[model samples]
Target: MPELPEVETIARGLAPVLRGRRVEAVWGSGLPLHLNRPVDLRALRAVAVGRTIRRVHRRGKYLLIEVEEAGAGIVVHLGMTGRLRVQPAEAPRAPHTHVVFTLDGGGELRFADARRFGWVAAGTPLAALAVLAALGPDPLSDLDAPRLRDLLAASRAPVKAFLLDQRRVAGLGNIYVAEALFRARIHPATPARRAASRAPALLDAIRAVLEGGIARRGTTLRDYVDADGNSGDNARALLVYGRQGGPCRRCGALIRRRVDGGRATFFCPKCQRR
Candidate 1:
């Protein structure tokens, strides 16, 4: 999944080109997105085709594009293998290029998802607001240990599971969760309430890893690219996400991996004590 950093990279890269541009023409393959077949594509075309984009905002893993002319917004979710790009109108279209928005200035904005996991919804302002309303807090906020404790004080789920829940803390997926937990030296299976005391270090690790990911563009294991179609470079700087059986960066102990909640959870067994 393209989490906070990856989505943020796309939003930032797209803001300059998308803002103030009017959608001159809209084209899309006749395929159902989000499995919400029978979706009124006409509504999207009618409301968005002529409207000018006023802003590009990000909410968790979603991108919100405000169309001021129509008093509406377009919401985009880059599920798994999705990529949004800005290119010349005459540029060659790649496979699975599902949606193309032709701008009045001869530029083209495209939404291409190799696996059809991504979706774009065009509607009134609520299109963006509904998405923003569903997510929790970002790690970059002033979410200190005590506050974090109040949030997870009731859950007995593993700490990693708590972090993965968007309702608990939005914009985190498997890769960053594993890395953050390892950095905080809290075992993934530790009960959430029991791990509350470590919230200060945990929050600090979350901010550091997420910020570092944004600085590096994002961590690209596969099929992730920014708006300019560039892969992330942060994979090289990862501490433990995919390093099962490898030496820990901080300790000589070998890294380990286990299946937790059907996801691969990696850690330095000796460094991340329960």
Candidate 2:
């Protein structure tokens, strides 16, 4: 799944290519991809056709493409597994391209998802508030240590569960959460409040890990790529994620893997003290 960094990279890439371009047409071939939104395929074309692309932004994993006309924005979510690609005008459309945006400038924006889990919606203000209103603060935004501490302290779930809760903290996935907790030296099985005293450090580590991933354009694990179809560089910089059976950078401990919430979590058991 493309987490915060990957989504941000996609938004940044799309911003340059999509700005100033008029929506010549908007149409899709798949069943309703948007979560709980109306699936009328033709409605996309009716409202979005004359509008100009204004800007592209991201909140959590959702990408918002603002347009001039009201209720005609494009909202994308790369669900458990989804990808967006900017393809050449003549390139053959791949299978699973549920949605395609024909640009006035002679190119196409394609939304292809093998899992059919990705989503697309059209609305002004992008319906961002309604879509992401339940999400917690972005770890890379104004969210700070004290606020994180309060949220964690208020939860009795396992720290990993708390970390994975999108309503408690936005933009963190299994990979980043495992990496951050490992860096903070907290066991994944630790209760949320067990690390209450170390919340500041944990928060800092979370920020550092996420920022590092963003700087590297996100980690490319299972088919995650930027809009330009480039692999992320952060996979090389990861300390714990996907490093199962590998040595830890901090203490030379063997990185261990375990299933948590049905997802793989990698950690340096020796370094991540319980």
Candidate 3:
């Protein structure tokens, strides 16, 4: 799944290309991929046609495209494995490109998903979207850290699991949580409140790790790519995200891997001693 950084990167890239450009039309596969309505590519065209894109924004992992003709927005969620690509309207369409929006500027924004887990829904306002309604504040914004600290302090879940809970801290996923825990020298298996005295530093670590990811475009461990079809460089700079048996960058201890909430977690056992 595209986490905060990857989604944010995509939103930023799409903003300039989409802003001020009108949606000329839309097309998509007729079958709904999941329990949701199969995107009637026609409905997309009807709602968006001639509506100029005002801005692109992100909340949690959801992408929002604001339209100018009405007080409305389109929400997109890139599930487990999905990709967004922008190509020339003349480019040959690729398989798995389920949704294509023809832009007024003669370009097409495509949504491709082999697993078909992603979704798109239109709404009157971004806030009324179901996903946005439940999502916590964005981590990139002025986060309520003291509130987060209180929340985590009350949970007995493993630190990593607690971080993965969107209600506690928005925008953290398995990848960044592992990286942040390693950066804070805290073990993924540690209880959330075990390091209460260092809560502030731990919070800072989370922010730093994600900010670093955004700065580097994001960590593309697998299929993630920006709108222009570019892979992220952060994966190359990762300290321990996918380095299961590699030496820890800071302590030289062998990086260890384990499963938490069915996700791989990498950490330095020695350095992250609880």
Best by lDDT: 1
Q: In terms of TM-score, which candidate is strongest? A: 1
Q: How much is the lDDT of residue 267 in candidate 3?
A: 86
Q: What are the Cα lDDT values of the candidates?
A: 0.85, 0.82, 0.81
Return the clash pairs for model 1, or none.
none
Give candidate 1's whole-model lDDT.
0.85
lDDT of 3 at 225: 87
124-219: candidate 2 lDDT, tens digit per residue: 445545767788988888588889889888989999999988898888888889889988999999999877788898988899888898899988
Q: Please tell me which model should have the higher TM-score, number 1 or number 2.
A: 1
How many residue pairs clash in each candidate at the backbone level? 0, 1, 1
The candidate 2 region of ten consecutive residues with least summed lDDT is 32-41
Candidate 1 residue lDDT tens string, 1-274: 5888899999999999899999988888877667655335676787688789899978778887888855477788888888899999889997888888899989999998888878887757644455566777867774667778877687889999999988788888898998899889999999999998888888989988889999999888988989998999889988999999899999889999999878999999998888
- Displacement of the residue 35 alpha carbon in candidate 2, Å: 7.4
Question: What pairs collide in candidate 2?
Answer: 71-124
Candidate 1 regions exceeding 4 Å error are 36-39, 69-71, 127-131
TM-score of 3: 0.92
